[model samples]
Target: MDAALADCRACPRLVAWREQVAREKRAAYRDETYWGRPVTGLGPADARLLVVGLAPAAHGGNRTGRMFTGDRSGDVLFAAMYAVGLTNQPTATHRGDGLRLLDTRVTAPVHCAPPDNKPTPDERDRCRHWLVTELGLLAPTVRAIVVLGGWGWQALLPALTSAGWQVPRPRPKFGHGVRYEIAPDGPGRSSLHLFGCYHVSQQNTFTGRLTPAMLEDVFAQAKSAAER
Candidate 1:
């Protein structure tokens, strides 16, 4: 799956943008080579916790080839996960930085980096196949999903439903610290619990909209749910 994901070129716009960013290179990382391709999901295959983000940052995951790595947003996320005993370290500097996640896996709806850090709806839909495949593979072990930001929340619902989780008709709204439980379709399937958290972006972290404590609290809920 990882190899297939790395070779994906289904979205022309995203492909162009990600390659462009890699070619131009960030001034700070001019000497460093960039992955510039689809960043595959990372963590244990039998993880109980799944974290979904919007997309790879142009200079972050796209550059390092790991989800949420080499970015400020990743710093906030890993730190909070560390406090909650989900990760071995509080910083995600690079792909080989030796960080590990316990009972948790991180992925994104969009595999490639997008322009201006935003992906169009069409691109998100086209990229949903990867996320759907990932969730299907992990559904047995995954008991809880922590969606970072409303974009991820929106992207995951359809995938979850398509994967056989019974979603509510009215649809749950997205908000920081919000949680909803979806019962499994039948016996032998694990029920899914969803937790929403503000994206660990500079816009939120820099302005105090998302604090360490706030993220920790959310992860605490995820940990408890996964353990149950």
Candidate 2:
């Protein structure tokens, strides 16, 4: 699945944009070869918890080849995860940084870095299959999912339905610390706990919209829920 995802070129616009960024190169990353392709989810298949973000940062995951690596957002996120015992370390600089997620996996709805950090509805739809497939595979063990930002929250709901969870009418709204328990639609499926957190973006963190303590609190709740 990872290999197939890394080689996906289903979205033409995303294909061009990712390659162009890799070719031009960010000045600071000029010496480093960018992964350029779609970034895959990181963690064990049997992870009990999941973290979903909007997409990779242009120069962060696209350059380092790992989600949440080489970015300020990741710094804040990993620190919070570590505080809640979700990770082995509080720093994620690169793929080989020896950082490990404990009973947790991180992924995104859109695999590639989108322009201006926003993906078109069409692009998101095209990429929905990957997320649905991932969710189906993780259904057995994943009990909780923390969605970072409204975009991810919105994108994830439909995929959850597709993966066998029943979303309630008048769909749940996204907000910091909002949580919902979604019942499974099938015999073999299990209920899922969905959580909302402010994205660990500079816009949120730089302005103190999302504090470390706030993020940690959310993760701590999620950790407890996952373990239960």
Candidate 3:
């Protein structure tokens, strides 16, 4: 995650976008300093499920220096993790919150915050290599993944497909609760599943597009897949 954070010069546009967001403080965010820098994602090294998100929020994780750590998204995410017994710390506001991930870990397609909360295709593509490496590292014990949006799912699909994970036909398009099992790689635990959920961003939750139940159901499926 650190290496990816450091080497992420992916989208020139995003690099520029981050710089701009860092420069101008919107009226609503007077007290907040935008963490335009790459956000460090957190998860267990031996986690069973990997959750993927779109990107950091300009004032949220981007400001907090930890992926999904200091935002409304983190609030919903950790709340669900605690509900599922997947997180030791009930809340994660800072990097030093003594929080720990249990069976799940969260990541994003891009490491930096994209202005207006949009990651360019180039940025997502560029970041794919790191995710591929991460998947390779995590695949041994990982049973499933929960993609938080269509963009995240698209960003991750290539790597999973290359790894021989199958996408069910009449194909499961991106949406909350959809699941796919990556074909078994070998004699040893070979299946990996991809589950879909709406991005737990401020827009979704604040706008009531997603709620605690929506978020919990995704993790519930993940818990089930991990246990199976």
Candidate 4:
């Protein structure tokens, strides 16, 4: 799936943008080769906890080829995860940075990095199948999911439903620290605990809207929920 995801060029706009950024190259990363493809989810398949974000950052995951790596958002996120014992390291600079998630996997709704960090509705819809497939694969052991920001939260709920969980009428709204228990609609399926957290974006962190403590609290709750 990872290989197939990497080779995907289903969205022409995303394909053009990602490759353009990769070719132009951020001045700081000029010497390095960018992955320039859809970044795949990280961590083991049997992970109990899942972290969902909007998409890859242009110079962050797009350059480093891993979700939440080589960016300020990743710095804030990985630090909080490490503090809560969800990862082995607090820093994720590159793919070979020796960082390891502890029974936790991090992924995104859109695999490719979009212009201005925002993917169009059409692009998001085109990429939805990948997330649905990933969720289906993780269904057995993934008991909890922490969706960062409302974009991810909105994108994830429908995917969750397609993956076998039943979403309630009117849908659940996204907010910091919101939690919802979604029952599996199929036989032999496990119930899932959904959590919401502010995205660890520089916009949020820079303004103190999402502090280390606040993020840590969310992860701690998610870790506990996953254990149950």
Per-model TM-score versus the true fold: 0.98, 0.99, 0.87, 0.99
Runs of candidate 3 with Cα error greater than 4 angstroms are: 23-35, 168-171, 185-189
Tens-digit per-residue lDDT, 66-152, candidate 3: 788877788988898789788887798876779888877788878888867877787777777677667766767888888998888
Name the lDDT of candidate 3: 0.77
Predicted candidate 1 versus true structure: per-residue lDDT over 1-228, tens digit per residue: 999999999999999999999999999999999999999998999999999999999999999999999999998999999999999989999877899999999999999999999999999999988888898889889999999999999999998887778889898999999999988875546988899999999999999999999999999999999999
Question: 181-226 in candidate 4: lDDT tens per residue?
Answer: 9999876569988999999999999999999999999999999999
lDDT of 2 by residue, 125-154 (tens): 999999999998888899999999999999
Give model 4's TM-score versus the native structure. 0.99
Candidate 1 ranges with C-alpha deviation above 4 Å? 186-188
Q: Candidate 2, which segments miss by more than 4 Å at Cα?
A: none
- Please list all clashing residue pairs in model 2, or write none if there are none: none
Report the poorest 10 consecutive residues by lDDT, candidate 2: 185-194
CA RMSD of all predictions: 0.9, 0.7, 2.5, 0.7
How does each model score on lDDT? 0.93, 0.94, 0.77, 0.94
TM-score of 1: 0.98
